[model samples]
Target: MSRIVERVRRVRFTWTHLAALVIALLVAAPLYWMAVSSFKGKDEIGANPPTVFADHPTWDNYREAFADNNFGTYLLNSVLVSVIATILVLSLSSFAGYALARLPLRGKAPIMVALLMISLFPTIALAAPLFLLMRDVGWLNSYQGLIIVYTALNVPFAVWILRNFFLGIPKEMEEVAWVDGASPVRTVLTVILPQARPGMFTAAIFTFTACWTEFLIALTLNTADRYRTMPVGLALFGSQFTVPYGTIFAAATVSVLPIALLVLVFRRAVVSGLTAGAVKG
Candidate 1:
């Protein structure tokens, strides 16, 4: 009877693995095709139907993407915006989250409700006002402008996520530190912040991804080729008359690789953050 039960469990596990594999393939197929097409010639890419592998793979597309388009500049812009925005979100949100979780401020409940409410509001609705504000501050077509907007947009969500994680931490640990004569700020930095590393990483990853893929605001604000980010740059890659699919795919692959690497490197942290939040609640 035990052997039969074990066999049934093994069979169930095998089926689960098989299902996951199929799902993964379904999701990855388009990305794989884009990568394959990036290496293929224009003629081969547009050939009847589509070939799985390039018959004559070439690095020409990547080279052309680099040379023709200011890909380097756009990549630099993306890196700058994403890094700055992530840093600002992490710093501000962590502080705000810590306060919301630990501090006994008046009207805290209402304030948190307001933040959550504002977070749910459509970003598109705020775009026009944000654009006008940027213009007034002479921040349009500037990296600083995009970074500020992205950071502000991302902070509310970050604060909510981090606050929940902070609330899960045992108060005993902080109290012990305080009893030992550590100041509140010292206790937070030395005790709580380190403990909340996983949540912080999760917030940073989400913020960076949001900024990296942001299009509407980036396009609307920075019309100049010099100030354009990767998304905007990719949008302008192909004209109506002529489309360079290979170059576009190559650029996209380049853009996605960094995000992929970031996920791969910090996947453990992201999982921990998610599971910790779930367990806390």
Candidate 2:
């Protein structure tokens, strides 16, 4: 009986491993193709349906991409906006989430419902009004403008995520802190915040990625080349007359690398953040 159970377990493990391998390949194929194509010349990229492997890889595409576009400026702008937005979202959302989850504030339920409702509102719906508002504030084409917009857009979701996390925390822990003469703010800062790192990290990663890849708002808000983010600036590589596929691919590959690295580095935290509340609840 034990041998049969062991055999069944081994079979299940084998199938699970195979499934994971297949899924990984499916997810990685496009990124791998993009990286490979980035190394190939334009002619090679345009050949028939395109080949997975490059016969003659060249750095010429990268060189052209750097020379043609102010990639540095675009990268800087994206980083700035993403970083600022992530920080703001993390700070504001965590506090709001904690208060909603732990504090006995009046009309809290209605307020949270309002926040969730705002989250459901489409970005396009707000674009016209946001554009007008930004224009009046002279924030068009500015990093601060994009940062504020992105932070506001991401905050509601962040609040919900962190609120769930906060709810998962044992109330006894904060009560103990309170009994020890820690004020509410101090208890939150020293006790709750440390425990909430996983949630904060998750929020930061999501906010950063959203801001980094936000093309529509950036394109609409910032017409000037100087303030354009990577997504908008990289589009310039493809023209009506001739598209530089290799260079475009190279730029895209590079653009995704930072985000990929960030995810890899904080994968554990992300997983914990996502699952902690769910499991606890």
**RMSD, each candidate, Å?**
1.7, 1.9
TM-score, every prediction? 0.94, 0.93
Candidate 1 lDDT over 89-191, as tens digits, reads 9989988999998898888888789888877878788889998999999999999999999988899988988988999999999999999999988988899
After superposition, which runs of candidate 1 have C-alpha atoms over 4 Å from their true positions? 1-8
Name the runs in model 2 displaced over 4 angstroms: 1-7
Candidate 2 versus truth, CA RMSD in Å, comes to 1.9
Write down the TM-score for model 2: 0.93
Quote the lDDT for 75 in model 1. 94
Candidate 1 weakest lDDT stretch, 10 residues: 272-281
Residue 113 accuracy (lDDT) in model 1: 90
Candidate 2 least-lDDT 10 residues: 272-281
Clash totals in order: 0, 0
Q: Summarize candidate 2's per-residue lDDT along 187-247 as a digit string, tens digits.
A: 8899998999998888889889989998888887898999999999997766788878888
87 Cα displacement, candidate 2 (Å): 0.4
